[model samples]
Target: MAFEHPYGSYNVQGSLNEWFRVNVTGNGIPAWMPSAFIHYDFPETGLISGHSGHAFSLTHQGADPIQQYQGRIVGDGQRGTLMESTLEVNCWLSREKAGGAYTHRLRHMGDMVSYIFQSARDVPLTNVYGSTTDPENVTALIRIKPANEQPVLPDPNPDIVRRRFLIDYRWLERVSAG
Candidate 1:
C-alpha cells in the first residue's frame, strides 16, 4: 500500500549549485523539528544535479529525546530548468537501534513541489511511514516558474529572492520487549 505526502514548491532562478536551505516545525502526537539544506550545482547542458543534507530531531510526550536522524540527497535533473529529479538519502541515528537509508524522487514544476518517500527495507508494520529517526525514502515533485524571465539591470548590489520548503513526519512505534 502507498500514501501521499505533499509539500509545496518554489520558483527561483540561479545556478544549480546555489545553496538552498529550509526549516520545518510542527505539532502533533509527536512534535517534529527538522532542518534541510539543498545545494544545487551549475546547470549543465545535459542535466542539472544537486545534493541535500537533512537533520531532524523528534520529541514525544513520554519518550526521552524521541529520535534523531540525518541524511543526504542524491538526485538528477531531467529537465533543463531542473523541473524533475530523483533523490536517495542515507540516514542514521544516535541510538543505532533504528537506522536505515531511503531513496526518493523529487520533481520541480512551477511553484509547487511534491515528495514521495518509500522504504528501503521491508518491516512488519501494517503501513510503512517515515519517522524522524527512520524517515521513509521520499520523492518530491515540485513546480517552479521564475518570477521574471528578463535579466535584472546591472547594479552593485542585487536583491535575490530566496524560498524555502518544510516537511513534517509523525508516527509511533510499539516498543518490543523481547
Candidate 2:
C-alpha cells in the first residue's frame, strides 16, 4: 500500500488510489508527478526554490464530461457541446524546510506555488496508459490554480511535516487519444 514520492525515499503509506485506474492513465505513474517542469518566470520576494517531482493526486470534480451551454443556439438547436473538465489535484508541500532533504523540498514547493499563482502558461500533464512498465505518454494541457494559504497535513513519517495544496486544473478541450 506504499506509493512513491518524488522527494526521495519517502512514500505515502497508502496505495495510489483506485480513481487513478479508472479516470487516469499512465502505467500507475504517481498522480502527484507534474506532467513536466516549469521554471520560475514571475516576480517573487522569496528565494528561488528549485523543482522536483512532488506528490499529488487527481480527481474529477463532477461527471466524466461536464458540459455548459455556449449561450448561442446552433441551427440544429444544439446549445451545448462539452464543458471543459475540472480536475482537483491534491498536492503535498512540506511546511518545514529546515532539514537536509526538506531544504531541497522547499525549493520544489516554491517553484510549484509560484507557478500555480502566476500560471501564465499551461502545464502539460502526461500519464501512462495500459501498463506501468510499458507505459505510453498521454498528455493533457491544464490550468493551475492559486491557493490562498497553506494547510497543514498529518505526516506519516515522524521526521517530515506535510502541507496540502488543493490545486484546480481544467482542460479546455478533451484530451486527444494520440
Candidate 3:
C-alpha cells in the first residue's frame, strides 16, 4: 500500500470575509423592528488582525419606509477589559424605525462560546468585563441610546426604567460570485 498524507491538499488563500444574519429579539425590541446583517472584512493578514481592526458594515433588508440606513464598525479596545472573551466591534446604525441613529456593539465571540456564555441571550448579572474577536462568530448588544430613544414601543407604565433584549448572530453560508 502507498502512504498518503491524512491532511492532503486544499485551497487556503485570499482574504477571510464573512456575512451574518442577526436576529433581534426581546421585549425591548419593538415588533416593527427589522432584521439586520453584518459584513466582516478580514484584514490582509486575516482573522488575527481583524480582532483589533475596524472591518464591519451593516445593512437591513425588510419592508419599511426607512431609507439610506448605513452603519460602520470601529475597534473599541478602550471599552473592552482584560477578561473580554470576544472581539468587540462598535457599530453605529442610522435611521432606525423610531427615526434616529443608534450605536451597538458586535461581540464577535464564536458561536459555541456565545451559546455557552449566553452573551447575547442573557445579560450578565455581575458585570463581567473584557472583550475579544472571533474569526467567524458574532452577537450584538445595543447600548448608549438615550432612554427616550431606545428601541422600545411606547409604554403605558411610567415606572418602567429599563428594557432587555437578545440580539443573536448566525453565520451565513458563503457563495462564490462570478
Candidate 4:
C-alpha cells in the first residue's frame, strides 16, 4: 500500500555556490545503523536546492570505517529561477553484514532528501527477516527563497528564507520491530 509521505523543507537565501552542512543521527534505533553527514553547495541560481552539488559520507558504529559519495545537481539552463530541480545521488554503503554496495539512481526532488536503511539480518523468533530487519526511511526537504518575499503565512524565521520538513519511519509505517 503506497502512501503519500510529508517531509521537512528548508529555505536558505544566499548567493549560488554557498555551502551548507546537513548532519544526521540515529534516534530510537541501533547506533550501529548507517548515518550520513552531507556537505552541499549551491552551484547557481535556477537550480533546485538539492541539485546543486554535494558530498556525503556514511558512518556506522563499532567500525573504524567510512564510505563517501559525491553527486551533482543538473538542470536545464533554459529553466528560469525558481524552477523545479531534480537530483540524482549515487553512493556506496559498507557494513559488516552487507559489505560494500553501490546505490544508484536515488532521486530527490526540490530540496527533499530521503534515506532508507535496513538491517542485514533479522532476529529469529521475531517478525523481522531478510536483509532488512526493520526498514526505516527518513526524508528532509529544504526550501530556499528570498527573505523579503512574504509567504502566505507568518515567517518562522524572518531573518532567512529557510524551512525544513522532516519525517521518520514511524510516520511512514505502523510496524513494530527491533
All predictions: root-mean-square deviation over Cα? Answer: 21.9, 13.7, 20.1, 22.1
Q: What TM-score would every model get versus the actual structure? A: 0.18, 0.36, 0.21, 0.21
| RMSD over all Cα atoms, model 1 | 21.9
Predicted candidate 4 versus true structure: per-residue lDDT over 91-170, tens digit per residue: 22222223221112112211223322222111111111111224222322222222111123423433212222222111
The C-alpha lDDT values of all candidates are: 0.22, 0.36, 0.23, 0.22
Off by over 4 Å in 1: 1-37, 40-110, 114-159
As for candidate 3, its clashing pairs are 84-130, 84-131, 86-132, 86-133, 87-132, 87-133
Q: Which of 1 and 2 is the better model by TM-score?
A: 2
By summed lDDT, the worst window of 10 consecutive residues in model 2 runs over: 6-15
Worst 10 residues of 1 by lDDT: 8-17
Error of 1 at 24 (Å): 17
Candidate 4 Cα deviation (angstroms), residue 153: 44
lDDT of 3 by residue, 44-120 (tens): 44221222222233222111221221221123311211111122222222222223212222222222122322433
Best by lDDT: 2
**lDDT value for candidate 4?**
0.22
Q: lDDT: which is higher, 3 or 4? A: 3
Quote model 1's TM-score: 0.18
Ranking by lDDT: 2, 3, 4, 1
**Candidate 4 wrongly placed segments (more than 4 Å):** 1-23, 26-29, 33-35, 39-81, 95-178
